[model samples]
Target: MAIPQLKDKQVLITGAASGIGRAAALAFARQGAHIIASDLRLEPLQSLQQEVQALGVNCLLQAVDVSDEAAMAAFAAWVHEQVGAPDVLFNNAGIAYLGKFLDSGLEQWQRVLNVNLMGVVHGCYHFIPLMLAAGGPRQVVNVSSTASYAPSPSMASYAASKFAVAGFCDVLRMELAGTRIGVTDVCPGVINTAITASGAAPSMQGEQLQRLQAYYRKEGCLPEVVANDVVQAVITGKTLVLTGPYSRLLYHLKRLSRRLLFKITLGTAAKVGYL
Candidate 1:
């Protein structure tokens, strides 16, 4: 797929207040994308707007919780009214939950699913149609994680949520192929985002956290790095993307050695004193 030129492209990003979202917002702005940056955190979104404006790209801020379909719908409507539908939508707001499957309460599980999976779903429901109607240079980028395929036993909920996002992106891409819209699913490995600090609960335990711990060092790729990868993916018509070598390795192993993966997961868990 040829890389799409981004000069003056209209882009909207959820979770743009910080971490990968904020980083990508800045990168896109520098490359000349008019940005609509949103987050639940008002101050950080304001900060993001300032930085993006400094890059000489138009930037707007909104305080939005992506899980709220009504809020997302209204947001889409506002963007249409104010600046027109976005050429690119980054459905990037997400959460991390690592806990035993049986132990996970409905509330906790639902919350994780809401943000990580339904957030993407809601964004598409409201935004994609408008992008189709508005037309041209339109794309959607969904940030998934390696855990979607390399499902960690303890982080079952988070893994499930991401899997849904990946699944949706894959199907949605095909569905929109004849239209003016494109979709990219990003499976980033351990990005140095506050997601570990803010999204994952301290109580997460078991074999899953062990595997994640093995992969996530304090020195993972910076949020900025994943952000750059995202922009590249959006520009290209890349359907599936892994942000790092580890993510690619994990995704392949899961495809090639699913049963062995089961045994190795338990064995590795036992070695780590997690099983």
Candidate 2:
């Protein structure tokens, strides 16, 4: 299929300071989109602004936390007041930590839900209406994960959050059925980023990084790959968007062999000492 075009459009990306968000910001900028890059990390957001601006596209940097609904509303309003309503909103801000459900503290669980689940909720509540008002060429890109397919022992809380996001995005897509707005869940397996380095926030990749390094790392992917996929999905309005081959395989297995895959997953986890 011919790739859909996204030139000269306004795009907003949360979690744009690092990892997939940064890559998405840069990628969209390369496509001639006006970029609004946001993250809790102001310094990195500023750096990304500089870098993308050097690419000769407009970039607005905002240090907004997606978990906060009030702040998200304010951020959207600011975008309207400044960069204009985004043709695309990458609701990509989230965090993860490793802990079984029982072992996870209430604080950790709430934090995870706030960012991973409620963050998406807040973004949708705030942005989708604007996209509807704008009437066309609008997209909402949510960063989910393959873990959303089922329960992950070590990533119980994190998986729960993603599951919520995936389901929520699905409903959002349905509700926007006749509208020009669309939703795409960006589910990626693994990508090489600082998700493992020191001081990494308790987000989706934080806890899994150590285990991947020990046993699961397999040729990993680049964030740019997901960024490219996001652009394609926005243009094509694909319901499900995954980054790598392994991710697609896992997705297929989830649909084709739920019981068998669950058993094998447990068996392999036990073998690898992850269970």
Candidate 3:
């Protein structure tokens, strides 16, 4: 069923050039929402704008890097000026880093956290005021990862950033409890996207990276599955959504037995040479 609230609504999404963000932009556009899409790349955003406009909805495209606070602030101002406050703000821009803590340097950790954690922060810091001013029913969706709860030794930076995002969402939700704005924490498991290939994994060889990418392509779920969950979450005011294959199972297992979850994850990581 189409959501009545989404029709003709203003929805702002970062990282909309590809992967989950791209899927989400299309999903929202299909519901007749006006899309405000951004990414660090321009070409893909243009292509996405064409697709979104073809869906018979308006799309405003921009090349904005979420990690850059000043740029994000300008973008937020532009959004407010262009279409007033957005009914939904999807802070979905993120990157991945895969390596043991000792193997990765400070630069790698900083880069990961800057994009994955601070990007979400920048979005909320700049856009929340606009939503507050508009003051009806609004949604803030933050894209976290299953790694937030189900930690892995090989993905130290990625896990840390996601854990921070999850924590931030929890606090933000509590703070906004009395308001009409709803916060959603979206945790996705493996999904077939270019992130696996584009992520930084310094220790892995070329052949190993290729194998890992192939594994994700074969075993991961589609990005649209997560996008559908995002739409449902907004409609129902869901606080937490675990999407994609093994996402729910992993969350449950982590809650059931952290030690067991670690044992299983560590064993699997070893098998895949991620250790």
lDDT string, candidate 2, 38-154, tens digits: 888689788788889998989988888888889999988998889667888888887766655565467777888899899889888998887788678678888898778844566
Q: Report lDDT (CA) for all predictions.
A: 0.80, 0.78, 0.88
User: Mind giving the per-residue lDDT tens digits that candidate 3 earns over 1-275?
Assistant: 11247999999999999999999999999988999999998888998999999999999988999999999999999999999998999999998777667866778888889999999999999999899889868999999999888866668889999999999999999998888888999999989988865565577757666666776888899999999999988888888999997799999998899898989998877765566
Estimated TM-score for each candidate: 0.89, 0.90, 0.96
Query: Which prediction has more favorable lDDT, 1 or 3?
Result: 3
Which candidate achieves the best lDDT against the true structure? Answer: 3
Structure candidate 3, residue pairs in collision: none
RMSD to the hidden true structure, all candidates? 2.8, 3.3, 1.8
Best by TM-score: 3
Query: Would you give me the overall lDDT of model 1?
Result: 0.80
Error of 3 at 184 (Å): 0.2
* Candidate 3 Cα deviation (angstroms), residue 264: 1.0
- Residue 255, candidate 2: alpha-carbon lDDT: 89
- True-structure lDDT of candidate 3: 0.88
lDDT of 1 by residue, 172-275 (tens): 98898888788888898767666754444445554555545565554367888888888887788777878854688777778898998777767754553233
